[model samples]
Target chain A: MSFADVNIQFLEAAKYTLGLFFLTLLIAIPLGVVICACAMSRFRPVKWLANTFIWIIRGTPLMLQVIVVMYGPGLIFDVPMKNRFLAALIAFAINYAAYFAEIYRGGIMAMPKGQYEAGKVLGMSKASVNGLVIFPQVVKKITPAMGNEVITLVKDTSIANIIALPEIILTAKNIVATYAIIWPLFYTGVFYLLMSGVLTLFFKWLEKRTNYYKA
Target chain B: MAFYQVNNVYKNFGDVKVLKGINLELDEGQVLAIIGSSGSGKTTLLRCLNFLEIPDKADIYLKGENIFSIDNTDSAAASNADESNISEVENGKNIQTDSEKNQPTHAKKAKPEKISKEMRKLIDSKRGHFGMVFQSFNLFPHFNVLKNVTLAAKLKYDAHAPKGFARWSKEAKAARKQAMQEINEKAVALLERVGLGEKLNSYPCELSGGQQQRVAIARALILQPDILCFDEPTSALDPELTREVLKVIRDLKKDGHTMIVVTHEMQFAKKVADKVIFMADGIVEEEGTPQQVFEHPVSEKTKAFLAESEKSIDEE
Candidate 1:
C-alpha cells in the first residue's frame, strides 16, 4: 500500500476508536454517577450490590473482562454472541464506570459533612442537597482523576483487538503485515498521543473553570 | 399565641441522649439566646427544630400548624399525638393508638397512615420559617456572594410557584421573570443590609470569615424565615470580626426579627437577647431575661458556666 493509502486506512480506524471512546463515556459516566449514589445509599442491600459490582470490575483486568463479557454468555447459556463492537463497548463501559464511580465517591466524601447540613438548613431537600450543593463540588474535585481515566480510555481502545475488532492498532497491524512495512504501527501511536494531549488540555481548562472554591 | 413552639423535643445518637425533653416557645419578635459549652445540645436543639437532626420524638408547631405533618392539618397529627405517645414510627406512617393501655403488650403495633401530598408541600413550605447560620459559616464554596443569597430565594420561589411557571409559556415566563426580579431585588437589599453589597461577586473562599458569615446571614434572610437561628455565627472569627457579625445580628434584633442565637459571647447575648437560655448537660439549666440569668443565676450549673466563661474572656 502507498503511504497515502495507509494514512487513510488508519484515519478510518481512528474514527472507530474515537467512536468507541465517546460512546463508552456516554454510557459509563452516567452509570458511574448512579453507582456512586448506590454506593452511598442508606439501604444496605443496594449499597452492597453496588460495591460488589465495583469490586469485581476493578479487581479484574480489562482484557479478561472483555473476553468474559464477549463470550461468557454464549458459552455458558448456549447462545452465540453477535455484535462484536457492542460486546467490546459494554465491557469498556462497565470497566470504566467502576473507576469513575470510585473517583466520584472520593470527591464526594472529601466534602465536609457540614455542607449538607448547611444546604438542609437553607431548605434544600436531600435530593437537591446532592444535586445542587454536593455534585458541583464533587465534579470539580474528580476532574483530574477523571481526565486520567479518559486518557487511559483513549489508549485502552487498542484492547478491543482482543475481540478481533479492527480498532486503530489492529488496523495498523494489518497494514504493516500487508505492506511488509513497520511505519503505520508507529503512526498509530501518534493518534493516541494527540488525543491524550487534547484531553489533558481540556481537563486543565475545566479545572481552571471550576477553581472558584478555595481554602 | 407563640409564633414557634418546640414541645418535648428529644434526640438520641446511638444511646447518647443529646437533647432530653426540651420544651420552648417563642412569640413573634422574641430573641432567644442559647448559651452553653460544647456537647450541651444547643446545636442539636436547633438542628432538631429545622429537622436537620431528626428528633427521635418531638412536636414542632409553627403558627399552631403541625410543621411535621404532611397535610399541614393540625388535626391529623393532633389525633395521632394522643395515641399513647409510644414513640410512633419515624415517618408518621405507623402511628398506632393502643386501646389496651392496661394490658402491657410485648410489642407495639404500627398503624399505617401515609402522609398526604398536601402535607409534604406544607412541610416543605414551613421549612422556610426557620433559617440557621452555622459556626463555620457553611457558605456554598462554589457560589459567589450574590448567588448564595439568591439561591434559596430562587428555590423557595420554584417550590411554591404555580405549576408550569417554570416552563416556556409566555405567561409562565413573565411570572417567573417577575418572581426572579423580586427575589434578586430582595437578595441584593439583604446583602446590602448585611454590609456585603460590595462583595456580591466575591466567592466564599475569597472573603474573610466574618464576611462569609455575613453572606450566610444574607442568604438565610433571603428566605424571609420567621425566626433565624445563629449557631455560634461568630465563633470562627476573631474578636474584631466577631464584633462586625454581632453588629449585623444586633441590627436584626432592632428590626424585630425573631431569633435564636447560640453563642459564647455573653456580652453580645446580654445586649441582643430578649430571653437568655443557659443550657448544661443536655437541658436548659436556667432561662430568664439577660439580667436574671447573668446577674442572679438560679442554677449552680449556670453560675459555674458563667464564671468559667468570664474567666476565659478575661484571659483572652
Candidate 2:
C-alpha cells in the first residue's frame, strides 16, 4: 500500500523480467546461427525441416506459443507440468531464435559471391572462409536488424505473463487487482523504458565498433 | 613438359559452352597475356586454373605433375584418375617428394584413411602454387592491408605445422610465434615491393582502388606462388590507376615471376607479355609472341579484336 512497498515489490518483479531478457538472448543468439546453418544446409531435408519450423514459429503468436508450451505436454502426454518458468523460457527462446535465424540468413545471403571466390583463390578451406572472411562481415550487416529484434524482445518478455510467470508486468497486474490502484501498472512502463534505452545505446556502440572495418 | 600446361580444357555452364578444348602452355618466369572481349571465356579459363570453376573435361599440369584432371566423358575414369594420384603418393612412388610428403607416414596413417585426404593434400599444395588477383581486387574487407596479405600465409603455416604436439604446448606456441614473425616480415617486404608499405595499417575501404589492387598483389605474392594469375587486374581502375597497377606487374615481370594475365589493356599486354593469346568464342584464335599477335595476327577474329581494342583506347 505504501510507495516504498510498491517500489520493493516492483524491484523484485524486475528481476524476473531482466532474467528472462538476458537468458533468452544468451540461448537464442547462438541457436539462431545453428538454425540458420540448418536452413542453408546443402541437404534438402535439413533445409526444409529448419525452414518449416521457422515458418510455424514466426506465423504463430508468442502469447499463444507460451500457453501451448506451458500446457501442451500435460494435455498431450498426460504428464504433470510443474515448471512454469522453464516452459516460458523454452517458448521465448525458440520463437526469438527463428526471427534471429532469418536475420542471419539474410545477412549471409547478401554477401557477394566474389568473397567466396577470393577465399578459394587464397587456398583457404571452406570452414576458414566462413569463419574468418564471411562471418565477420555478416555480423556487421546483421547488427542493426538484430538490434531491432532485441528491442522487440524486451517487450515480448511480458508474454510470459500468460503462463503466470511473476515477471514485472504480471506482478504489476496482480498489484492492480489486489489494491484496486492503477498506478502500479503504469509504473512498470518506467522499467521498460530504462531497459530499452540502455540497450539502444549499447547497440549503437556495437555498430560503431564493427564499422572500424567496412564491409 | 611445360612448367604449367592447360591441355584441351573444356567448360560449359548449363547449355552454354564457355571453353572449347582450349590448349595452352607456359614456361617458368613467363607472362602469358590472354586478350578477349566480354563472354570470350578468358575469365572462366582463369577461374578454371584457380580451381574456382571445375572444367567439364580437362588436364592441368603444374611443374610436370598432373595437378588436375577430369574425364567427364566417363565418371568412373574421372574417379580413377583421383584414386591413382592418391595411390601413387601413398605408395611413395610419387616422382616429386615435396615438403608435404616429408611428414611421418605413421602419423598420417593414424587417421582413418579416406581417399579424399590424399586428394585434398595434393589439390591444396597445387592450388598454393598459383596466386590469383581478381578484377574487383577482392581484398578481405574486414582485415587491414597487412592482415590481408599475411592471413592466408599464416593459415597455411598453421595448417602445415607438425602434427604430434598439443596445440597449447610450449613448443607449439613458440613455433607459431616464430612462424608468425617470419610471415609478417615477408608480408612487409611484399607490401613495400608493391608500393604499399605505408598503408599496412589501413583497411581495404580506406585505400584507393589502385592501392587496394596493389594490396591484393602483395597478398598474392606472400604465398610465393610459382605462377600468379591476374583476372583483369586493372579493369576496375581508371586510366591513372591502371598505369600504377601495370607498373607493378611490369616490375614483377622484371623479377622473373611467371604470370598469367587476363586483360584488355593491349599496350600493357604488348609491353609486358612474353606470350600473347587472343581468345574468341571460348577457343584460342591466335597464340604467338606479342609482335606476332599485334602486328601480324593470323586469325581474322584476332585482327578484328585488336582493331576494336585500339579504337576503344584511342577514344579513351
DockQ for every prediction shown: 0.42, 0.44
Provide the lowest-lDDT 10-residue window in model 2 chain A.
A112-121
TM-score of chain B of each: 0.82, 0.84
For model 2, residues B6-31, the per-residue Cα lDDT tens digits are 89888766556789989999999999
Q: Write the per-residue lDDT of candidate 2 for residues A1-215, one digit (tens) a residue.
A: 87888889988988888888999999999999899999987577998999999999999999999999899999999985799888988999999999999999999888887788788779988789999999999999999999999999999999999889999899999999999999988988988999899999999999999989777
Candidate 2, clashing residue pairs?
none
> Judged by lDDT against the true structure, how good is candidate 1?
0.82
lDDT of 1 by residue, B1-316 (tens): 4888887776665556778778788888888999998989998888767755545567777788666622113444577666654332234433333221111121113222233344344455567788999999988998888988898778777767667524767877788899999888888899899998898889998999999999999989988888899988988999999999999999998888999998999998898888999888788889899999999999999988988887854585
lDDT of 2 at B300: 92
lDDT over C-alpha atoms for residue B259 of model 1: 94
Per-residue lDDT for B92 in model 1? 43
